[model samples]
Target: MSVYSMKTGLSSILKAYSPTEREKAKNIAINKVRFEMPKLKGILDAVEAVNEHNNFQPLNEFVAYLREAELSDNDFLRLMSDAHKLINDLSPKFTNLVEALISLPWTKRQPPALQAYAEFYIDIMVAHNKYVQFGIPKLISLWIPADGDAALWPNGSPIEALKTELEAVHRLLDRILTAIPMSFEIVLEAIESKFPYFKKATHVIAGYIHSVLWLIEYKPIFTEFVVQLVLQKLVLLDVNAPRSEIEETDYDDEELEENENAEIFEMDDCPKVGNIFAFLISLTTTDDDVQPMKHPIAHTIDICMEKMFNFLNTKNPNLLNASAEQKLQLNKFWKILLSAFDNVILPSHNTHHVQFLLFYYCSFKNTIAEAFLTSLWDKIKNPNISAVIRQAAVGYIASFLARAKFVHLPVLKYYLKELCNWAHQYIQSCDQYRQNGSLKANIVFFSLCQAVFYVIAFRSRDLTVDRKSLLFLQSLQLSAIVTCNFNPLRVCLPPVATAFAGVTRAYQLAYCHAILERNARRKLATVYANDVATPEETLDTFFPFDPYLLKLSEKRITLHYLQYQASEAEEASVVAGHRSPRRQRKRGDSEMLDDVDDFIVADKRQRNIELARSQEREAQFTYGLSPGFHM
Candidate 1:
């Protein structure tokens, strides 16, 4: 008979006999056989027979019967209960039965059937401990909705039905954990192995991430592991998704407004007309001179980042009014986040957006901010840490202090003093080694000095607000640090050095014009001397916590972010004379005027050069060179 005829005939046969009648007939046939056999032995023989024949008729029939039977059917419940008892006898060799059980649709079943299936699943794993390895993976596979179902919910909101199904999955997992406490490692392994690839559909990845976060609530022991895993994935996406790609994509305001409320799960529903990946790919084909492009993952990064930020914000909605218990919980959460930062985010290079999660979290309280600053300072001061990490740490500290609107003046001054004191001590200690040291050897000191200057340039208005603050700034001996023999002005990026010089000169805190003039002349002379100028050192700008540019998360960051603006002094000078005095030549002191003019011209020229170089390195650090650094 054809396959259709066979299926029709089987369906008719199943319909002809109720489960009760079938069980009674089975009993009668066994009695007539006149053979004494244990029930477990009979089950084993049936399984062996199925395997020998390479047929799954019995398994298929059982699944079909369960599907067709009513939830309250006693025969269905008893059959499942008996199968639960025979779980111990089920072996890997019983492939058909194992496959059938694994393939059962628990998600759509009624509560009683769902419970029965869950119990049988747990019993099988509990009976055969090794099955946990396979079973946990199967459960994890249900974490993401099927693609067709995801398409149905195009807005990315979790479907209520699917949510209920996932809740059942988690509860089943909870019971499995209770029965097999030692299977935690197996579950973790399964989760990691099944983690959605970063390039997968945003909803799929977000769904898995949401499930992982949900798992943390019930299994608190997995907090650190889960946090770190999520962060690692976020970092992977952040690093690959260059901010420039997003900026360069051709999108209109209406589309951006539409996408503003879009969740990670809703990325598929996002319009493809202005997609960064599509724009980039189009460029590749249309322009013969264009370089090959890496497909942009910015949308994916934005979704993941928004999810994480939401997760954290929900955990500590009102830190101020939180009770002691809530405070303790927040504290524990902070520790886990900090630890994850150190292990995953800290060491990472070229990550544009993931680090802002720490920034947003620290904004909750002054104590958290202070603690974060202290952590970076400790790392910056540690001589044993790698220079690269120390450099990145100092960059983070500077950016955090400059951009964080919540950091009060005293706190800023306190850290500024700390940084200046450290720079002073470092300059003094490195003075003896300065003669023999290469720029690479003392890069950390140069980085620290750059950080101090960058922060001072950013907060120049606050620093020189009054006599007391000016005196405090003067007392930090920034002049001495800048004028040190090490010559950090020349070693740091030109734009930062120029801004620091301009701010100090305007405030009368330091006289760096001469040093900058000298450095600029030397750079020019080196270029003239070589037929092909080879730079002695190439320093990529390191600003870890720059403007958070991910479109979806920008609102959260912008509220707390202190944007760069001209100081009152500079603004007034511009209003009065159309240019600052430092930019114009002085009346008396022709030599000094000449020096200032040369410094101005050279600063402008050096900026042009640096801009070109920055463009070259744009692929490596998209946000590294911010326009805010320019005076």
Candidate 2:
């Protein structure tokens, strides 16, 4: 048959076919193209000449071109959109034509055509993906870092070698990130009713979700593809996430913040993001049973937490309103959530960002979550960190303690004791940090100290630490000496000053009491010789109010500055403010949070400075902030 006959035949079939019939016709046409693609391979050089000279306008259109009796792939997508996807117009028609040739079976006469077409298609996709949406393009750059080789990737693609062909491959992955998942929406509909096997491949749906999240700016754009991605990555418990997720997920973006020290505990059977993070937490401890997951899993979890915030942001999922069990599960994972407090979401790094994350978080429980808190005193005293991170961490801690005044997490007692112990050691180690003044080290120290403070102050009394309740006050005084007062951003303290400053002064009294108790234990052990370490017995505050926190609160100071008057308060009738503990929220969590957060601007330097003054003056005053605070 003539090439014109084939083209006319396909177009006529498409124009007349019904939806069901079209799909069938598309299959037949696709197979025909497969057969026909090779027959035209003999005329490749002629087409290349036309392409190189840029003189084929009248000769061939994008969908189909006939040069000297040779046929090319049809770029007419409307005619064959159902059958072939490579029918691109905006970028280059040559790409689609080459791709068609590449997919041809490698008969003796057409061996090189298939390979060349494959390489060309890859090159086109990479270029198209770049600078278009910039989502997938940006992502591929992260995954395919340049090695010395410039021709191909280690995984068999053309990326590792930094070749121009590989450059196009990268662009293609980027464009695919935006384009393919969109195609998945139609695919999902097909899967649901049109095809039986579609539901079985939810993993692919989930994979798309993970990408669409970054690409999508608004909620209305959520497609079946994006939803599936979330379902697979965050909610899917069956199969481990694909190996690509490891390349896609690890980042330090969620590095625990400076003042949050909850030692982010998690159950062993938790989800991948949490379970692996929990294991990483265990590596910081002395537990023999806490073996790490394989290194690859750890990398994936880290990536998910850091880079994938664009995917699964910790702020809140779009879907909510859990059953009692899910709520309980949420409560169960408060420790895991606590680890997020110190998390510095690069986007959410500012006070605005913190408010955004907290707006989603605060709706689940009154006051900030417990695991998210800090020791009240330590956050108050720290001068090393900017007041921005300092205030957010403190407010979260206060809210946490208010909630803690009720029945606690049960395991919190042990968490607090460990925090106290870690704080005690870490403050001492701050002096030894190689780059003590480096921002990373300071943030790490801030996070470490804050985590310790939460450990000591908010710990449950159930666990015994040396037969004495771990001294929360003593822990803060020590952690703060190095943290709040020792501004490495300014100058390092002298050795004697560092020693005398942190815990040495106030802790001497606590230490003296502890020493007396230890001596009594030693005397008894010497006499009896039965080996059992003393269990630390701690006491909890029965009263809802804490005078120590009341004195040190910046919230009170902010209120004093605002005179408790909102610049533009939400209307009492239109939007019942969250300030009314009794009022039911009228808006969505994010909206109500938006309204609440709308008033609290972080850049109000005058207000924060006044709050800082209040904290410095009355260390014993009650702040009435949120759930938890530094000791």
Candidate 3:
């Protein structure tokens, strides 16, 4: 056979089999009619029945049939599509149908069916605005997976079902928000009411966290509200999990290892025998055989923090690739985070880890770090603020300066100088007024002094890098602040006071050993004289940005943390040509003996003279401020 003949034969065969354009159109129209006829009939029947009887029983029956039927994914999708077409006929009066539709396990359906259900929900919400109050909460409830259902797969991956459901739910939310923007108020309220409690299973709380982050991604308008809400919840958890308890309890290595390996979602039914959650579960069981676990609240806190840290990192903008608008948005978010920190986390005491959210945030830029320091400083200096809040603000500032590696020396010195100056002015004011009140009366002054000492103890090496820096440090007059009548060294935490003394003595910046020895002698005398009824005054060792202890979230913290270097203090002492002679001296050495003798003599002379002056001025001087005088 010739090639041309074969080709001609094939072409003729193809031409005979192919349909005409008109026939193709006719077939499409015929299929459309066949598909829509039943759907139209169902929609008309539902609408007509509801309009005729002025009740939703027919629509309710239709929803119940859809729920009871084990239809294939495509059939279910077609029926939901038909339901969507009746949205305009539906109203707030269709409560029974709405409730039945809401009760369906739509999240368990396949992707196409899930999407069809979401569309129907959105269409109903948009067509009847009053239905939004019901629809939004129903969708939000799907964000938290029910018990035994979090792991959809037999293999038990965490939050797998929740992730799938949230994807569809958030898409439905985005569509509804676009159609009726006013529905967001309902959305926010539902989210708040549906947020999982801190004591709920870790995966359940984590599922809600995932949904929140998803909302922020799809709906940028919720960014501020979501950030505040998450932080507030985190603060709640943080306060409950006290750092003191974490420190006091000794966790076994095996238990910690078990907690690390245990799956988050396995807590409800099959917790590992000795893991943290199992210990937590034991509390509810009637059996008294199980011993208490160490710091189970800490474990919950770690999981919550890990999720929150990941959310923040996701929302963190990349400075290298971000545009101006992105940067502006980031700045706005930073401000919101700062506001939440001030309102929620700052006033909270004994919180172990919540403030790290702000710590992680300030690392985004140097300007943010500076701004945060400035805010803390403003709080510290503002007299109108409560004493307790001002004290906490100072602690935050000091801890931030001490532990944040990203804070440059110039910034540290700037705040250090500001703190010292504030303390100096406080001392001067006390002196000018002869306000020699007790330690309790002058607590804010002592707190400021302690913060100064703490910052210097942590950053001594950074502060003493050069002659110019040394001069700057000397100009702060820290010696005057320490030697003031308020006597911070005597009232502050012993280790802090000792560390500050060692650092100062090594640098020749101040001599505190004599004063410390005198205070120690006075304390002993008071104990011996049965004068111990006076409660000892001391500042709490609250380093807010201390080492991040969460095993999962520590990675986010360590990259920006400035670890304490014991060698820095020793090296600074060596370089400054000052070494402790007490280490080498015998107890009876004459030089040490003479130094002690001189301290005792000076203390006695000052006390005698002050006692005489007090006797003379008793009638004229008052313990408190005089009339018409203001501090």
lDDT of 3 by residue, 305-357 (tens): 76777777765766578888888888788888888888888888866689988
Instruction: Name the runs in model 2 displaced over 4 angstroms.
Output: 1-348, 354-407, 426-631
| Candidate 2: count of backbone clashes, pairs at least 3 residues apart or interchain | 67
Q: What is the alpha-carbon lDDT of model 1 when measured against the actual structure?
A: 0.69
Look at candidate 1 and tell me the lDDT of residue 626: 51
* Number of colliding residue pairs in model 1: 0
**RMSD in Å for model 3:** 20.6
Choose 2 or 3, whichever is better by TM-score.
3
lDDT of 3: 0.66
Residue 266 C-alpha lDDT in model 1? 38
Candidate 3 has which clashing residue pairs, if any?
Answer: none
Q: Compute the lDDT of residue 438 as modeled in candidate 3.
A: 76
Collision pairs in model 1: none
Top-down TM-score ranking = 1, 3, 2
Model 1, 1-631: lDDT tens per residue? 4567687775333346789999999877554342333222333445555657765544444444333334344444555666777786687655455655655556777777777788888878877776776788889988875655655333234667777878999998988988999899998898899998887876788788878988987888888899999999999988877655654452335544444333223334353542455445444542223222223477666666767888898676365688888778778988999999999998998788899899898888888888999999999999999998898898888888988878999999998999889888877777755554566887788787888888887787788788898899889898898888778877766556666776776777888767766665666566568576644454565677765656555556765677555466644443322233433211111122212222222224445344434323322222225523321
Q: After superposition, how far is residue 57 of candidate 2 from its true place, in Å?
A: 4.1
Local accuracy by lDDT, each model: 0.69, 0.33, 0.66
Among the numbered candidates, top lDDT falls to 1
TM-score for each predicted model, relative to the true structure: 0.75, 0.26, 0.73
- TM-score quality measure for candidate 3: 0.73
